[model samples]
Target: MDLLRDVLKGQSAKVFFSVFMALIFANPALASGLASGTSELTAFKDWVWTLTGIFVFLFIIVQAVRAMMDQITWLEFALSIVKVVVVGGCITVVTWAMGVFGVAP
Candidate 1:
């Protein structure tokens, strides 16, 4: 019974080591095969713009509630507009670049 348990444990360890090595070898190959240039940069830019838009929208809503509409500062309004424009512009640019480069999946 003890020998059987040891054999089972050794088999499990071997299987685990095989899986770990396979993942280690596969990761670099996958990363190297991906698009690296403008595609990657544009993806990062779009994510930043999306997060900024969400933050600005939430801030505007909170400020509008905290202060009366007339008392709200122009800076806040300008920031909100800028966030919207940035997000929209990023989406447009990424879409155009993807089409122009034929980078679709």
Candidate 2:
């Protein structure tokens, strides 16, 4: 499970873990009645993304602080921001693909 561990250690892992934990602990009844009880899924998705957004905000703040402190170069700070944006875009694309395939919640 080293691969999984590595994945979970990345910057976007906060988002991934929030989504993962929500799904893992999802209400069985709500999850089972997908057609009639979509509220649960929608709320869970929102919650996960909300948490992810908060974590992303925190990451940017930390990066900004580090840059201000000269711990990392300005170029490195810009690249980190780009990396975060790229990762977020990738997630958006993946979710879009899942929806297109009628596999998303």
Candidate 3:
């Protein structure tokens, strides 16, 4: 359990750092003219999507760590399920909104 926890902690930290760097350093200009809506709104939506993906991926990793540690009880599993459902629903809603707004080409 200790070993699994240690590995997961290290890996999670690495993933978090990488995502943070990407968010901070990614080209702002790439978002410009890439979508059809106002540049500010398009950029905000893109950032939201990117951050959501990062968070979901991190949740999956943490759940795997829990499994590895034999710590996935019914409650834990249920919570994970809820997290996935909520994130997926949000993604769907945001995607539809973007389409309806003609934000993406």
Candidate 4:
């Protein structure tokens, strides 16, 4: 009975210390840096660049797929070109918008 009591008390002390440390170390302000308009804008811009690269890579892969399809017609090639152009234009527009909005660090 005494050993069981000691084990339970040790577990209770660990729980209490963990909770106390969590409260002591917690930072509520940075929980969502976007909410505070902090450094997360830099993170957002990095993500935008990463996504832009991914889209361009995917676009090239799609163009390659289109080229490999033996029965692909001129209209299909034209549509692929149009798709790439539209995506490029959209990326440019977003970058411009971000610049105008002062999303930079």
Each model's TM-score? 0.36, 0.62, 0.45, 0.43
Q: Give the total clashing residue pairs for model 1.
A: 0
Q: Against the hidden true structure, what lDDT does model 2 obtain?
A: 0.83
lDDT of 4 by residue, 1-105 (tens): 854676587776766777677774585644545655466656787898899789877876776677678557657767877887897798789978989999842
RMSD of each candidate?
10.8, 11.6, 14.6, 9.9
lDDT of 1 at 8: 82
Q: What 10-residue stretch in candidate 2 is worst by lDDT? A: 27-36
What TM-score number comes out for model 3?
Answer: 0.45
lDDT of 2 by residue, 1-105 (tens): 765776678846776787777885685655566564677667888999999999989998999999999999989989989998999999989989999999964
Q: Write the per-residue lDDT of candidate 3 for residues 56-89, one digit (tens) a residue.
A: 8898788878877888875786689787998799
Q: Which has the greatest TM-score?
A: 2
Kindly indicate the candidate among 1 and 3 with the higher TM-score. Answer: 3
Best candidate, lDDT:
2
Q: For each candidate, what is the lDDT?
A: 0.71, 0.83, 0.76, 0.72
For residue 102, model 4's alpha carbon misses the true position, in angstroms, by: 9.6
Determine the C-alpha RMSD for candidate 4 after optimal superposition of all C-alphas.
Answer: 9.9
Global CA lDDT of candidate 4, please? Answer: 0.72
Question: Where does candidate 3 have its weakest 10-residue lDDT segment?
Answer: 28-37
Q: Regarding lDDT, does 2 or 4 come out ahead?
A: 2
